[model samples]
Target: MNRPLCIAHLYPDLLNLYADKGNILTLKRRLEWRGLEAQVTLVTSSEEARPGDYDLVLLGGGSDREQEIVSRTLRRSRDEWKAAVEDGLPLLAVCGGYQLLGEYYQLPDGTKVPGLELLDMVTVAGSPRLIGNVAIESDECGTIVGFENHGGRTTHHHAPLGKVISGHGNNGTDGHEGVRYKNVFGTYIHGPLLPKNPALADFILQTALDYAGIDVKLEPLDDELEKAARTAFQVRRMNLSEVAAQTP
Candidate 1:
């Protein structure tokens, strides 16, 4: 019998701006389908993040104001989180959460949002938000698809999560999409991210399981619909690119 997978969802009420709850649902359902049990604990602003109690940690996007609030809340327990990540806790942080995991994020008005310094990166907010369907070739996973919408351009000094294939990733000039540090992954893409990329989801799950000393292999599921959705998005992205090319 496989041990139950425990997931810690950080700030669900404050940081779920982009249907990020879908990520939790996707992870839980996938585990259930494979006959494995999943337990998700919502860690709010009032609660401390105990990484050792969970197999995986999830942080989602939020508004700038919410990000500030969350940042302040996290500061109280920064050492706990830092130690957790260093101990190989699997983490997935998207958009605002991604920025918060970095060194800092500078707002357009020159205000600075201090990060946990967990990842060696910085995000600077600028004009013309990168909003569109995105595709990338991840070094750890494979082809990944999602949507990106952010004015903050992230520049990382560490290994990137993936190279941009059909979207403006990171700063739009670096051709990188996200950052990967140890078992933690950060990205700007969030069509809830996981439903269309089962491979990436499984990678995260397996990594978390492995860290927990659970050696059970995840059996494959019927991903026909998931593949079709990914293909459709790829086709649409290609068409859009072609149209832009012919615009001149």
Candidate 2:
């Protein structure tokens, strides 16, 4: 793609907890390092753009109330958004985003907020919020790291959204993690997953490249910088694990 890559950041109003916006910065920098210019565009309920305008779409984690707020707009533009995904557009949705993609999110008062149902899953509200860091090992992918913080538990009505390598996902129900289908990878992992796990980051970038039919070399970062990055990642993982172990 000759033009600078555009990323559609959906529901920034409610889906940016944990400063997940940092992930976008990490992605942008990584892409620029690989010689692909990147641009991030925000899309709220009031602002809707054509699917073809972006190379990637992102939905971050947010509060239940915020999720409901964003849902209003999502419900209105869901068809166009779904069409974009059907066309193989790249998407990365976090906790709130992940829940919104399911059939529906069961609220506390027996009320239900309808979801896009883009994936075969349902998020049911739970008590004693699930929070903490997680560790995951993907045979097809690799080691994955991130934190999970949510009160809703997701159940895979059909196939499991994804496998769990580490951490308490989907409310410790074994399906605690988010769903990943096609070029879309939805998870509860917070910001810094990209900076910590460069391999996964490259995987995402490669997915976009593959979709665009672009072949590019995966330039390796300097050994010193790579080690420092991994060390920081490990430290975070260990700390979270320790905290979770002591939570009870």
Candidate 3:
């Protein structure tokens, strides 16, 4: 008998700010729809989150204050996360989680907050704030739609993250958007992308499957559900492009 896939979510310190739990629920439901039992574990600041025990790990967005809280906890767990990544454990980190994985984050006052150094990226915090919908053109995949409300822009050194297909990404200026290091996927979009974009969810889940060495047949979703998800993603993409063009 195959056990259910275990997914662990790092609660950090704040889970309500960006309301990123939607991503987790989206994945869980999607898996359930595919007849796969999914189990979720939330590891808070007080709890121990060992990445090796889980098949998938997710981290949500948070504020600077909350980032501090999560970063502090991550600093202690850095070794575990680094090891997990090195060992090819799947990870999905968004916004503040993305920032904390970078080399550093520069505040508006020119104060530089050190990051976890997990990914070779730097975030310039005091920059053009991008709030609203975002469209990204993936190098590995296709159009991805989500919302971005952030005060920082992340830049990758030596290696570039994923590409931007539409909307202003990473400070609403840079074409360099999102970070993809190894099997770790970090993005700034926070509309809890999975619910509205099932392809992206499939992409992530497939990655997890590959990592776990599970060679089951990839199930195809129903036409109605697929159409709905694609339509939702398109609406978001078009709406964001309109907003971006009108903003300036």
Candidate 4:
């Protein structure tokens, strides 16, 4: 595995709300830190690339307007994209990117943003948005922490990444937080999503390595700072729901 892993970062310019591009940096740096090489290519509507053409793909959060633009871009490569995902391409989609993987995300005023339909799910705008720190319990990754802020209420038909340990998940009603299908993952978690959760990041890299036919178990890296961040995170990270539940 001397060759660099090709990473396609989709819509960095438009879908970069809340420093979403940080996830891309997190992935690339993690690979390098492990003595592995990774090459990232920015893919936008103008630079649409086949999802299967890369070792990994990352779609970050964005606004509704940006989602519409990306939808059209993806529509051009729809079949190819669908084939790639079905073929087990390791993809991580966050926030608006997560919604893009579903059937459709219906807006408050009745405008439905078209999605890639890769996942059997739908997001409809709710009255108040789901926001604040998120804690999910995953059997594979243990307790994962991040921030989520969205108005969409998603109904998932796919297996959930984990149960909600804190904060609002896919929908406040459901105890789940993200979607897991084949090698593809969709989540509303963002705090740039990977820096605090190294296990999940490495899980994606390992899956990508496996998908790319690279025979290697990922070497573990020290996550002391990441752990410390989580420890400190409990101090100020607030969730309205948690506050309400604890009220006497």
Candidate 5:
């Protein structure tokens, strides 16, 4: 019997400010729809999260205080995460999770929130939070869309996931949206991320499959509903673009 692909959702309780569990659900069902099995394990504490137990990992967004709580567990399990990434374990980290994976996330008052150094990046708190719908053009995944609501401006050294097509990305000034280093993906777009972006979801799945050396080919899924969702957003994006063009 084939074993199911295991996924670890770290600090799910504390890091689910944007209902990111939908990202988990998206992965799980995408597998099942292809006649494959996927098992998601919620890992809230360091002790329960064994490094070698998962094929992939997900770290969702959270508020500053919530992230502070998760950071303790991450510190305790930092070695495991670092090792896993080195060994090519696929990881998707969003917003606060993304910030924590970097060098530091500095607060407005100049307090430095320590990071795991998993990604070579830094974030500084900024005024006028970037909050809106986002669309980015990615060579790997076409036009990816999501929502962003953050006060931290992040600067990183790596190939970004995509160029900003619609809203404020890592920083409002830079036209980049997210970071892609090896198999780890860090993004600020939440709105539960993976639901409408099937291409990005499958890219993550494919990377996990490759990491695990699983040779099974993932069959294409019918995504009419997902297409409908994207169509609606595309119209809204156009309207926003028109509005921006008319602005001073």
Candidate 6:
């Protein structure tokens, strides 16, 4: 019997603004469908993060106030997380949580919001929040689909998760969508991010399982509904782009 996959969901109460809990649900259901046992634990602001205790770590988006609170909490466990990542633990951080994984997030007023420095990247707040359905062409995970809504423009020296194919990503000027380093992934894409992109979800899960010393191949699940949802979002984005281009 395989060991149950353990996922530590950070700040489920606060950093779940964009229905990010759906990502956790997607991961759990996928594992259950494959006849694998899965466990998800919510790590709150009061709790210390023990990354070594979990196979996968998930951090979702939140409002500015909520992010500040979580940032302080994450700082307390920075060393633990750094060690865990070095040990090959997988992490999926999105939006606000993604920003917190970087060097620092600079506010519009020039205040610096400290990050965990897990990834070699920096995010600066800018005008006109990047909000829309997005598609990206990834080198490792193929095309990824999601929605992004953020004011932070992230710039990284490391390899990007993917190149933008549809909507504004990262800084809007850059064509990149997210940052990828080792087993850690940081992205601005929300839409809960996983349901419409099962491939990406599986990639994270597999990585987690691999780190857990499990070598079982994952059986494929019926992703017909998932694919259709992705296609519909892509079509909608295309239509919106066409309309914007034709206007004026």
Ranking of all predicted structures according to TM-score, beginning with the best and ending with the worst: 1, 6, 5, 4, 3, 2
Give the range of the ten consecutive residues with the poorest summed lDDT in model 1: 43-52
For model 3, residues 67-181, the per-residue Cα lDDT tens digits are: 8777777788788888889888888888888888887888888877777788888888664577766777776657677778888877776343456666567656568678777
Please, what's the RMSD in Å of model 3?
A: 2.6
What is the C-alpha lDDT profile of model 5 across 38-126, one tens digit per residue?
A: 98899874445776888999989988888777776677778887888888889999999999989888988898888888888999999
Query: Which predicted model would earn the best lDDT?
Result: 1
Question: Each prediction's Cα lDDT score?
Answer: 0.91, 0.74, 0.77, 0.88, 0.89, 0.89
RMSD of each: 1.0, 2.9, 2.6, 1.9, 1.4, 1.0
Give the Cα-based TM-score of candidate 2 against the true structure: 0.87
Error of 3 at 160 (Å): 5.3
Tens digits of per-residue lDDT for model 2 on 1-248?
Answer: 46666777886766788676877887888888778877789886678656778778778888888888877777776788788788898888888887888889999887788888777878888898877767666544576776677888887654333467666776686643666676677777775456666777777776776666566656875446755866786787778678878997
Q: What shift in Å separates residue 231 of candidate 2 from its native position after superposition?
A: 3.5
Model 5 misplaced regions, further than 4 Å: 45-47
In the range 52-118, model 4's lDDT, one tens digit per residue, is 6798999888989999999888878888889999999999999999999988999899999889888
Weakest lDDT window of 10 consecutive positions for candidate 4: 233-242
Give lDDT: candidate 1, residue 101: 96
Per-residue CA lDDT of model 6 for 141-204, tens digit only, reads: 8999988999999999988889999889899997998988889988888878999999999888
Q: TM-score, each model?
A: 0.97, 0.87, 0.88, 0.94, 0.96, 0.97
- lDDT order, best first, reads 1, 5, 6, 4, 3, 2
Worst 10 residues of 3 by lDDT: 158-167
Ten contiguous residues minimizing lDDT sum, candidate 5: 43-52
Indicate whether candidate 1 or candidate 6 has the larger lDDT. Answer: 1
RMSD of 6: 1.0
Runs in model 4 with CA error above 4 Å? Answer: 235-248
lDDT of 1 by residue, 1-248 (tens): 66789999999989998888999999999988988899899999888777779999999999999999999989777988899999999999999999999888999999999999898889999889999999999877899999999999999898888999988999899899988999999999997999999999999999988998887789889999999999999899899989999997
Clashes of 2: 3
Model 6, poorest ten-residue lDDT window?
212-221
As a TM-score, model 4 comes out at 0.94
